[model samples]
Structures are given as C-alpha cells and as structure tokens.
Target chain A: MIRARRYQDARAQARSNPELAWWVFMRVSGVVLIFLVLGHIYMTFLLTSELQASYSVVVNQLAQPVWKIYDWLMLTLAMLHGVNGARYSIDDYVQKVSRRVWTKTLVYGLAALIYVLGTMGLFIISKAMLAG
Target chain B: MYRAREGQWAFALHRISGLLILLYLLIHVVSISLVLFGANAFTVLHDIYGFWLFRVGLIAVTGGVLYHGFNGLRVAIMDFTGWGTAVQRQLWYGVLAISLIGLLITAWVVVPRILAGH
Candidate 1:
C-alpha cells in the first residue's frame, strides 16, 4: 500500500512540474543515444584502421543513403538531448528568470544553427555523391 | 553547495559528463560536415584527429559517454518504472560500477591500439 502511494506521489509531482517532462525526455533520449552513439563510435573508431577512416572512406560511407539517415538521426537526437540538458542546468543555476530566458534563447538559437548546418551538410554531401 | 553526498556527486558528474558529450557532438558535427567541401578538407581534418593528442582525447570522451549513457539508463528506469524508484540508490551504484568496469576494459583494448597508431 505504502509503495503504491509513494509511486502515486512521485507521478503527481512529475505531472505538476512542466520541467519534469523535459527530465523524462532526457532519460528517454539518453537511452536511445547510448545505442546510437556507441554503435557510431564502434563503427567509426574500432572497426577500421586509421588508414580506413580517411576522407575517402567517409565519403564512401556518406555516399550510401542508409549511412546518411543513420548519421542524420544521430545528429538530431544528440542535439535535442544535449540542448535540453543544458537548459535544465541553466534553470537550476540562473536564479533570475529574465537571465534564464535570455540564456535559453541563446542556447536554443545556437542549437538551431548547428542542427540546420548539420542537416545541410548531410544533404549536400548526399547530393554531391549522387552527382559525381 | 560544496558539501555533497554520493548521490549529489553522481548528479554533478552526470551533468558534467552530459555537457561534455554535448560539446563533443557540436565539434563532431562541424568537422564531419567538412566532407561536403570535398576530399582534401575532410582528409586534412581526419589527419588531425589521427594525432596522439586527439587519440588520448578520445579516451576521455569514451569514458564520459559510458558513464552518461549508463547513468541515463538508471535515471530512465527510475522515472518510467515503479520498481526502479525503490532501488534507485542501488541502481546508481550499479551504474557507477558498470561504467568503471566498462571503461577499464575499453581503455585496455583501445589505449594500446591508439598508442601504437594502428
């Protein structure tokens, strides 16, 4: 009975705070990112020699549509996950609301810029490969 | 703020590691984007990453990623499931243990290879 009540209370608390949703997102995304990132590291670093990781190797890999999607997913998830985490820190450390708002605006702007650029890079590379 | 317990330390470390991973992601995205510039730009960047210092940096990144990834799982279990909250502390310790052991194994396998520049 007590355990159930405690669980209910925790759930209630989470529901009450909007920020808790982001917290949940962090956990969920973190789990997914673990698989994505570890796989990426294994494939990029461990699967090949230094020679194999050369520009040509990367170009070849990006030439494949599947690899492009895989990388795009990795970039998108990582940006959202990390940016939300940083926003949490900003909320915690910055006492003033106005300051927090400004900081978050800056953070979000930068994240958007990076995400756009990354997407463009992936698309451009795919097009270049297809053309050549 | 200065005095902290095990859980607090864990939280702090998670935050730091999370931030580091994010920073690295930013750099990784920009660098990989260089592929669009053609072969020479991409290969030049790859050559820089092949240096010993960057290889050493990879160890730190690997460690950070392991801890954050495992700890994030623990946090997720606690948040999304009923049973996990009951043993949250134990789960955290489990995360730390796994991270340490996993990192040790990774370093053992990777460090030598990186050092020898294969």
Candidate 2:
C-alpha cells in the first residue's frame, strides 16, 4: 500500500509499475463507484422500500438489459475495489510471510467466487425461468 | 497501541468500514443469488429479512457504505489535488457530516417501515 498524500509521492514510492498502476486504479475506481453505489443505495434503500425487493421485483429488474448491465458493472467494480483495499489492510497488519500469503489467497479466492456468483445471478434471471 | 488523532481515526474508520461493507457485499450477493433456485428458495428471505435484527442491520450497513464512500472521495481528492492535503482535516469533517446526514435520512425513511413490518 502506497501511503502517499499526493500522486507524485505515490508514483515515486511505488516499487514497480503495477503497484503504481494499482495506486491509480484505486482512485479512479473509487470515484466511479462513489456515484454508482450511492445511486444504487438511493434507488434501492432510500427511494424504494425494502419490501419492494421481493422475488418478482428483483426478477423483473434483472430481466431488463439496462439494470443487468448496471448491476454487473457495480458488482465487478465494487468487488475488485473492495478486495484490493482489503489486501492493503492484510499487508499492513498481518505479519509472517506465510500467513500473509495464505490470507491473500483466501481473500482473493472468496472474492472471485462472489464475483462469479453475482454476475451469474444478474444474467440468469428471466420470467420463463421463474415460471418453469 | 499508538494514540491516534483525526487522520488516524479517519484511516482506521475507513478500513473498518471498508472491510465490513465487503463482508456484507459477499453475503448480499449470495442471498440475492438464491433467486436462481426458484421462488420457493428466494422467498425464504422474506422471513429472515422480516426479523428485526436484520432490518436494523441494514441501517448500519447503509451508514457504513456512506462513510466508506465519502471518505474514499476525500482520499481521492487528497491524492490528486495540491490543496487537498492542506485541508484534509476539514475534508474529513465534511465526510463525517455528510455521512451523518445520509445515515439520518436513511433511518428516517426506513425506520417507520421497519416498525410497520413492511
């Protein structure tokens, strides 16, 4: 984790090109996710009631291509962003190289699984499937 | 343990909130994914969610997301801008204020509904 207050510091402190790239990705993805996620909360939790998230409502929303793409974007972006952030935490607190590696492997594996599950759920829903 | 001031508090809160939100997201994805199993499987959520504990937990999740998102914006601003570092303390306050407002708004809107059992 590059703990720099400015972009120049981050660039200079980066051990490798990919580390610097991830430093940049965190900011970029963080900005985009702020809007996407806040809007999602606003629509789902603020504007609409939780009761509206009933099975039929969720199925109908997923059936639409627009919501499917929007949710997929959120799932992918948020998962990557959150996983990377957690990796930084793991690096900071976890001592012992062996423990760190195992922790990271588990974290990455779980993130991948959740990402695939979320993506599949978003795409696999349709009225016919629900009926059948 | 090191004694922390505003910046440390900000960093600590950001990390805790970020990890908690990620945990919630994993569970959320799995629960929502149950739709693939058919209505019978999905409807199980109605009973679980109707539980008061889960309903209240959603409010906490909302607050956590708000703080993480706003503090994240503060970090981005500090990263890319020259003046952002100078005013980071103020920016941290702004993040907290905004998050509080969001939490209040969410609770206001959702609390009654939860009470009414909707």
Candidate 3:
C-alpha cells in the first residue's frame, strides 16, 4: 500500500517497478471503472428493474455482440481492479506470512475461476441464442 | 483503537466497501454464469434473486458503489493535487453528499418497483 499523499511521493515510496505500476493502475482503472460500472448499474438496474429482466430478456441482450462486449469489458476490468484492491487489503490486515499467502492464493484462485466462467457465460449465451 | 478522524474514517469505509463489493462480485459472476446451464437454470436463480430480500440488498449495493466510486475519486484528487490534501476533509464531505444524493435518487426509482412486487 503506497500511503503517499502525492503522485511524486508514491513514486518515491514504490519499492519496485511493479509496485509503481500497480499504484498507477489503481488510479487509471478506478477512473475508467467509475464510468463503466455506474453506467452498467444505471442501465441494468435503475433504468430497468431486474424483475423485468427475465431469462429471455437477458438472453436477447447477451445475444448481441455489443452487449456481450460491454459486459465482458466490465467483467474483466472490474475483476482485476477489485482483486488488486482486495490484495492491498490482505497485505494490510493479514499479518502472518503463511496465513497471508494462503488467503491470497484463495482469493486469486477464485477470481481467476470466476473470470473464466463469466467469459464463457457471455460467449455461450450468444451460441445458445443462435441455436435456439 | 486510535482516534479515527476524517481520513481514518474515509480509509476504513473505503476498505470495507471495497471488500463488500469484491464479495458481491464473486457471487455475481457465478450466479450470472449459471445461464450457461440453460434458461431453466438461469430463471430459477433469477427468480430467487428477485425476492424482496435480495432486491433490497441490491439497493444497498448501489449505495456502496456510489460511495466507493466518489471516495475513490477523492483519493485520486488528493494524490495528484497538493491543495487536495489541504481540504481533504471538505472533499470527504463532498463525497458523502454526492453518495447520499445518488442513493436517494436510486431509492426513489427502485423503492416503488420493490413495493409493487414486480
């Protein structure tokens, strides 16, 4: 966790290249995700209630390449961003080295599994739509 | 416990909401991915989520997203600008105000739908 008050300070504190990269990645990804995620929530939940989004409606949307790409972008970016943020927290609070490694392994494993699952889901829906 | 002034509270809330959102994201990916099983599988899960309990939980999720996003921007501002650190307290209040307004607007749109049981 780069606990610097300024970008220069963050750069100064960064112990390695990857550390600096992640510090920059958080800010960049965060700004992008703010728009992507909030727009997703607005469109999917607020603009239209989830109750109205039945299975067929979901299929219809996902069948489109556009919505597929949109969702996949959100899924990929949000997962990476969220996972990295979680890693920071884990580094902070999880003190014991062995326990921290185990915890991080579990989190990263789960995140990778879900990312693949979500990508498969997005593509599979289009195929299902075509076959039906 | 140390005295948690504005910055401490902001940091703590950011961590909590970030973790909560990550937990939700894990479940969300899995649940949505059930669509691959077929419409029946998808609809079954969807209906379960349509329960009022889950719907209300989503409203809280919206609130969490707003706060986390806005506070994130505030953090970025503080990191990039010198003056941002000087007025971090004010920026934190602004973050709260924006989050509250967004939550209220979301509730206004969603509460009625939840009430009608649609």
Candidate 4:
C-alpha cells in the first residue's frame, strides 16, 4: 500500500541522517511543551491579577532554583523544537541548493543568538535574585 | 503555493504559527533581559504586558500555541508510526477539534478576566 511505501521512505530518510531523530524530537518536545506552556500561562496570568504579577513576584519565583531550571528547560526545548520545524519549511520551499544552505545558515545563526541571549537573561536574573 | 486543501492549510498554519512563536520568543528574551538593567526597568516592561490590549494579544498567542502544539503532535505521529498515516486526515480533524475547544475554553476563562482589567 501507499502507506507502507511512505513508511519505508521515512525509515530510509531517517537512516541517512539525524533528521529522523529530530523529527521524532519535535513531537515529543511538542507534547511536553504543551503542558509546560499551559501550566506557565495558568501560573503567570490566571492565578493572579496583573497587579500581583509584578517584577518582584517574578524575581521571587526565579530566586528559587527549581523555577530557574523549569524555565530554562522550557526555553531550550521551545527554541530547538521551533527552529527545527522552521528548518523543515526552509528545506521544502527553497528551490536552489545553494540558497537553502545560505538560508539555513542565517536562520541557525539567529536561533543561536536568541538562545544565548535568553539563557543569559534567565540565569542572570536568577543570580541577581540570589545575591540581592 | 495557493493550495486550499485541508492538509495544505494545516501545513501553512503550522509554519506561520511556528514563525510567530519564534518572533515572540525573541521579543520575550529581550524584554526579560531588561531585568538586568534594574527592577524598575523590568517592572515597566512587565506593566506594559499587563495592559489590557497586550492581554488580548496574549489570547491570540495562546491560540497559536495550542494549535501548533496539537498539530505538531499529529504531524509527528504520521511521520513516526504506521497507523498514523493511514488516518492522518482524521487525525488532522481531531487536532482541529481539540484545539478549537481548548481555545474557546481559554478565551472563555481569559476574556472575562481581561475585561475585569485586573
């Protein structure tokens, strides 16, 4: 059947590179992100009014090591999962091989920059909370 | 390009939502980074987000995340498992149904709170 052939193609494609691994990762991470993000929204927005979700409240939360780790994990998974998904779109739409490479390079570069900045912002706030 | 089929539209939504989330992430990182400057700076940014208009925007974000996360799961299942592809179209509908219900519930809960302006 066509399904079997498509499955075989997927297996072969996965064998050739790490694309398959990432393909699987997207799903797994996506499920986890759903919970994490929903929980985050509930805690940040639903649990309290805007007045209560002040800078001090956030600082107080991040001061705890657990929150710091939870947020970092959320950030890491979200970035990797999202960037990989975008890469798939880029590869599919970009016609020329050379253009694809350049586009991916640019995309990856921006992703990395955002990741680093996010990490720094997260950790620095944690440190500041701890010290002060 | 310009395909109006369900699958194609789903694909397009996934791409668009993913990119929008990425853009939001960049802004979120930069805004949070303002905390490093001082608590006053961070508080200002936080207050801006607390504005009712921004809260409404967040409803759209919640919808985007719900759709993307659920649809991504469907896409993943189709790619990984044998049975998934067999019922892929059904699964897409299932995803839409679940996401719609979820978004509606979220809007139901959030809109009133936003209107209260608290």
DockQ (C-alpha based) per candidate is: 0.54, 0.83, 0.84, 0.56
Kindly give the stretch of ten consecutive residues in candidate 1 chain B with the minimal lDDT sum. B73-82
Q: How far is B113's C-alpha from truth in model 1 (Å)?
A: 2.5
Output the better candidate (3/4) by TM-score: 3
Off by over 4 Å in 1: A1-11, A14-21, A49-51, A96-99, A127-132, B1-3
Per-residue C-alpha lDDT of model 4 across residues A35-104, encoded as one tens digit per residue: 9988887777566654576666767777677888898999999989878877877867898999999999
Candidate-wise lDDT, in order: 0.77, 0.89, 0.90, 0.77
- Cα TM-score per model: 0.85, 0.96, 0.96, 0.84
- Tens digits of per-residue lDDT for model 3, B1-118: 8677999999999999999999999999898888788778888889899888899899899999999999999999999887988999999999999989999998999999999997
Q: Model 1, residue A119: displacement in angstroms?
A: 1.1
Model 4 misplacement above 4 A: A1-8, A94-105, A126-132, B1-3
Ranking by lDDT: 3, 2, 4, 1
TM-score of model number 4, chain B: 0.91
For model 2, how big is the CA root-mean-square deviation?
1.3
iRMSD per prediction, in order: 3.3, 1.0, 0.9, 2.8
**TM-scores computed on chain B for all candidates:** 0.89, 0.95, 0.95, 0.91
The root-mean-square deviation over C-alpha atoms between each candidate and the true structure, in angstroms, is: 3.9, 1.3, 1.4, 3.5
Question: Candidate 2 at B17: error in angstroms?
Answer: 0.3
Which should have the higher DockQ, number 2 or number 3?
3
lDDT of 1 by residue, A1-132 (tens): 011223345456664565555555666677888999989877776665544676666777777789889989989889988998888688789889899899989889888887988898877665455345
Model 3: which residue pairs collide?
none
